[model samples]
Target chain A: MTDMLPTGATIGILGGGQLGRMLSVAASRLGFKTHIFEPGANPPAGQVADRVTTAGYDDIAALEAFADSVDVITYEFENIPTTALDALEAHKPIRPGREALRVSQDRLTEKDFLSGLGLKVAPYANVESPDDMASAVAQIGAPSILKTRRFGYDGKGQARLKSGADADAALVDMQGAPAVLEGFVTFTHEVSVIAARGIGGDVACFDPGQNVHKDGILDTTTVPANLTASQRMDAVLLAANILNALDYVGVMGVELFVTQQGLIVNEIAPRVHNSGHWTQQGCTIDQFEQHIRAVAGWPLGDGSRYADVVMENLIGDDMDRVPEITREGNASLHLYGKADTKPGRKMGHVNRITPRQN
Target chain B: MTDMLPTGATIGILGGGQLGRMLSVAASRLGFKTHIFEPGANPPAGQVADRVTTAGYDDIAALEAFADSVDVITYEFENIPTTALDALEAHKPIRPGREALRVSQDRLTEKDFLSGLGLKVAPYANVESPDDMASAVAQIGAPSILKTRRFGYDGKGQARLKSGADADAALVDMQGAPAVLEGFVTFTHEVSVIAARGIGGDVACFDPGQNVHKDGILDTTTVPANLTASQRMDAVLLAANILNALDYVGVMGVELFVTQQGLIVNEIAPRVHNSGHWTQQGCTIDQFEQHIRAVAGWPLGDGSRYADVVMENLIGDDMDRVPEITREGNASLHLYGKADTKPGRKMGHVNRITPRQN
Candidate 1:
């Protein structure tokens, strides 16, 4: 029986980005406290949480103290060091467990897991070394992508292959690190389905969102995704299946590509996602609240929307146009407490809610 | 004209109850830093804010330093001394300003302002001394309430008089302090309209909430109030008229009694009102956020709800049922980080949103 946590329990979170910040807000709204563990000088989540452990990920004593302080452990980002998780697991439960991380840390392993679940995936091969790279590329063919798999986010750690000469150069550029060669798909659009699973195995999903990315980062996510009814059903079923198979006890995002042929898996994020930010304004219970409920051992709220929504990320300099956007439409502006607006940084987002009726 | 008070500006908040706590959350959400100013050692609002200024209200040095550090000053409760407001106003602006607080702090003065606007109010009189008590009671009625005209909340600082014999005793019991005697209303129901006036004189009101009170404190507020379209129209008009009269900038909650005669004014809070907590889940922008926007010189957001909502306060030991309440329905729960929950104290509230088919 899952009886370790109660309503007033404190949940430990790693990483202090907007996801963690939103997670802390959601946790408080549900009678729970969140203690954020972040390495930086100041994490955005620290501004609104009960407590914060400001120590590097490798600081064992800090990690030990953090583990001693919280009831259970969860993370906002998946790139937390394996050793850190191993040490924390000695004391508290880490939901979506370390096994899920092992399966997802490497691109080759992730694709294998998706194929094992009988899900559609891009043709992929493991690039063990530069010597074996040419043969692997020949099998996967040109116009493929070479990805490091582990610790890659926002289009980093991945190289695109366009021709035979480019394959060897990409493999050599990767420097013998274990990589995966994924055949490129001619997809019409990209979408993500965010779902959650409670400890009791109860599952709920938000409507899928059609996402547009620029410079390899999320730009906009529109709900009521441009998908056929059957295709939307397939996305939810796929997300739930992934959560169940991993025994996940929180929210997870499943990103996929919609092509003329069918749905192809792109990636899996085992936490609250950016694409679901529209829920804050459009739905009764949002993804962050749903994630908190699942992990806190409470029943999930109804995740139904009363309006159609469009959420646009205010990346870096885009934040300067908040006044203009506010004047243009009845949009809700959310700016993160970031100190410097450097290039490629996520500054904030704006949510525009429209009546369902045309 | 509104420049330099950007996202990272710190706001100094006086009082640290649930109102201050919610204001701190909303302030942090907009990338603004909040520094809570309260005399107590531990206040719930401190848990989420950036800093806490623990000093006596009259400590002019601490107050000066606090005002110097923050861009502006605001408070949760309206009973703050005029001297403190004077000292702070010398350094920074006070939103909704001191005039609004002075009027709302004195019940007799508040009634004058409302009556000046031709709004309906219970017949009242000022009793400055025991010599005038009998005349004041006779002018109002036998079944009238004798209340101190200043600094009263949650059934405190007042006594009720049912007959002529008891009227003298009630007047003596109040120690010959300044008081108002009001004829009791046999109202059909009670409701409140929470409205806001931005710095640019923009006015917006949430749907009026039908309220229930226990021990003269708000117990629950149900939206999609049991009011006819005409009544709703009157409520909005009354609130807007008050805003224009006061030249107010920030949220205001007006308590009203729906009597057989007509709508009668009960009381008015010049800041974010407790009865409006439902706006957090029911609307795209909550009253707290709207107030922050008005004070910060940002454009107001849409204060419209897409669904009907019921918000119930969790007072004192009622917080013990938080786990059960959170699991029973699609309720969004909010708990203040108070260490002790004394009797009749508001520890938090829960909002249940139920979409209406109109």
Candidate 2:
């Protein structure tokens, strides 16, 4: 790839939340300035970024100016407006590419794409209308999840169908948006591999982190996840396959379900994942820096875990524990400079670290 | 201590250099915003900091405005002007306080302070005139070094006397500036103890790092320094003693010489030192973050080293090796966002890490 971006290049980032804030810090560490394109006023990313353009993604003039100013464009979150990408792509390269975003933006497409690769994914069917929902319920059966195919995150835009009797209510919950009915996988645990693909096609994956969710949001992620040696290898190989298939460049968070049959693809986020936050304390190169390196066309860093870490998200009221957490010497606190602490908001995270066992 | 300054409190940093840049990044990590006060345009720290005020320290009105804007004041460099501190002291508390600056700003005062603390500093004498220089040489002997008492850094404003020859020329080199003559310690290796003092008088010290100087400029700092366990303890104890004596409220880098007699104090930096940069990759809590925590009146982090790290400085032309360094998976690159690369300028550093031995 064209002699890794020389020092002093500007990285244009979409979405100016905590992820963008951390990414901007990582970019600055690598001698790159960041220009945050955040529609919101006084974004957290703006506090650390070199520049911030406070304009909506639909503002073509602002988008063009941002694209023109940066050497490369990347996003902290998926579901970027298509028009924004169109405007940005004409000006600079967007790492992770449009294909990754296109496939992962919708639940149905992501499942179909994973299934197409001969990867095991939860049994799923697309649902558009009431008849389609009935048909999906018949095929996927009860105890399935009905979710909007796009722009859904956390527990939002989703409903659980305990039985075929709840199909009508589940479908209504999708609010007429194109939806997917996914049969729940009988899994032992949920784990995520934070992997990166360089411009040269080299791939590296951090050790999978065993995750727990509270209120459908990631609560904690612990490294040295309970896995056989073979399972660990399978996780890395599968993540690499997905990155390669999409011709991806930059970091990706691949969620997987460990079932008795095999590993099932849960989902993929085309950016740094909350589950990977432990890497900041456990590894030499963090996920944010790894993403920046890939987007900058530099060689991928070793994702080897040097320490065992447990990362707990400080969501909303969880921030009240800051005083106590701050006094915990082993805990490395990372607070997102968000002013408000409304319920369910990710205010920060703390990574408690310990030496790894041989 | 003052409830830890609360999140989002602004930290006013004097001297917008690489140290300030890293400190600002650390402050941001802790949810604290940083305002950089710099006389130069587009300083490296300003690129990452939330705010930048471009004005000389002597500007009383600007200083007052900056002091009013920040909740607390701290500095990156020791040679802060007296007038600036006088203007700021009324509006905000400066951590590490005036005593650190008062002693460290002059080579003579620093030596006297260290010696008064029962620390073994090099044999030294103050030089204000030719008579003093002549007396110093008569008492301390030949092959000693003469350095200006103030404003000397990175081998600048220094002269060496060999066999008492060129004494007149060495004195002339001072240009009437107050100077100090020091007898060299017959040491085996140079090491630095990076120590921090919290607001509650709690002290934590990282293991000493073996440092190598290239032409009086630090080139590399490797952890697990060549020292006996007893010597290591002494280093930490002496460092803590210095902090306690000053009633220090921030990180200090204590340079020492391992001599046949014992460890001798070389000097101490009142702020984060370049030698401690390796902690960014080697420890869970790095020196920069430690400094931030101390200055912010938060509990000091555990200064535990989890990995053995060799940090190599990327000085000016050394940046040409960045591409090669980037390819090294074990290397964690930290580049200061410097636009220009002049000879003798520190552009960046790379921390090469390996798991520590049991």
Candidate 3:
């Protein structure tokens, strides 16, 4: 068994966005200081982290220095460049490991991996060229979505196809980048299972939360998601299967589509997910803290929900209501220290908690 | 009403210890940055704060720079040098105000203020010399405790007087500092109410938590304390009275001794108290976050308890049990990033939570 990190160990975080900021706070709660490495100056995580290295991922010297300064490394985002990981892995251990990232970094690979584990996912076909797009359309049919294979997030880098006649436009939207045509599933609603795997391969999963997205961005996630007991069990089991298969040792957010047939895998985030923010108010230990514990080689905490919570994201102009939100008796607000409030950008979130029904 | 601080405003905190560390995290959660000022090198708060000013309180230049950089100022420890506060207050507003500090900084003043407000407090007499000690003993009688008037905490600068025979020795223990003779109250148990006052004079108090002390240090604080509904209401009312008395605009920890007759105010802390740490898992917003909200002139969050929590302190060697503690399914451990753990030094705490019964 791997030795657990003692208090006062420094954790190297690869990104400095809101996820990294929250992760840094959680790391500090566990007596771990974080050193955030981000290309952007004055990133959110840097505001609370012990230190920050402002350099691009391709800067091998910076990566080596960051890796050498910390005991263990973890990342807030999975789109980290392969060359950067190659440099970092040589010097330090990265929890969740490289395989988890390699699988989730690409759309096609994530779908293939989930399907290989006997989990149902949207039918998808790789589209490398215009001809491939026609073939994909023929196979996957119309009313599918064409998404880039890599480096897409928050509804970015995706194009919708209404019919076969729209295939050429969707193909053009891909800008000749490698893409995947995913046939849309007629699902009732979306839910996500936030699970963690300890270094010793122990898996723990929080209750799945029903998610609602607006304009391709997550708007709210409510606990006690409309899931039957059997569906809940399947959600957790599938998430655990993915974690164990990858030998993952960190928190993973598995977005699932609750359909008439069964739970279909939508996607997976290898770090703390937005849908899991409700856990901060609803569970004993939140997803960020659980991730910190898992990466630090501590035992995974019980992720059972103790309260019903609805977590709503404060996006851009939604931040204008903060003063009023602050006055709400049941609302717990969490704001990221970002200066700019661009449209669709997440500024903060609030979790409204209520007593759990037995 | 004071205008609320904008999201990006900086909060200046004095005494960069564990309290400041937790407060800094809370400030970050509200989109505010913290600048911690401490005389010691590598203070715990510095690990999670946006800026750290390592300079003595007497350093006027450093104080000026810090005050100029922050919108509001607050202190973690009440023993801050008067000259320092005078310097900082000239530049920025200090929430919970200087009056709250002046009253709580000295035990005698605190006792006097509570009694003047028609709150029950243990009989106390000021002691400046051996003659005064003898007079105090004559008045307050035996089984009294001699505590220094200033710069004392965690049972320090205190001597127990069993009878008249021990008066001289107890006076000697004072080391010539001004003291207070507090007649020991026969209390069934101790409870503390964590309360907050917003800039708008809105007050909110968390349910009192029963505290257990070991060797004059807080060991555990359990919510749903052994109190009748009447006692609970009295605790909250008295706490609110104290806050209004000082026109306080921040969190206060009011420690009370439950006597057969009524609740006696033992003392009050101007900042978030250790006994209230249970709220981190029991409430929608923890005491630290409430303190930040009050100081920032934002609306106070609901302080009602939603869970039954027992918070246990990890002091000194108790940190060794952290590995075992982390493994406990219901435990949520919070470790201070203190490099050295001397005997009696608080290392961290854990809050074990369960659902609240209706």
What's the DockQ for every one of the candidates? 0.55, 0.80, 0.78
lDDT of 1 by residue, A205-225 (tens): 988999999999999999889
Candidate 2 per-residue lDDT, tens place, A1-358, comes to 3659988999999989999999999999999999999999999999999999999989999999999999999999999989989999999999879999999999999998999999999999999999898889889997999989999999899999999999999888888999999998899999999999999889999999999999999999999998899998999999999999999999999999998998999999999999999999988889999999999999989888888899999999998899889889689999999998899999999999887874
Per-residue CA lDDT of model 2 for B78-164, tens digit only, reads: 999898898999899998899999999999999999888888998999999999988999989878899999999999999998868
What TM-score would each prediction reach against the true structure?
0.96, 0.99, 0.98
Better of 1 and 3 by lDDT: 3
Q: Is the docking of candidate 2 incorrect, acceptable, medium or high quality?
A: high
- Please state the error at residue B222 of candidate 3 in Å: 1.3
lDDT values for all models: 0.85, 0.93, 0.93
Clashing pairs in 2: none
Descending-DockQ candidate ranking: 2, 3, 1
User: Compared with the true structure, what per-residue lDDT tens digits does model 3 show for residues B13-119?
Assistant: 99899999999999999999999999999999999999999999999999999999999998888888889999999999988799999999888889889999999
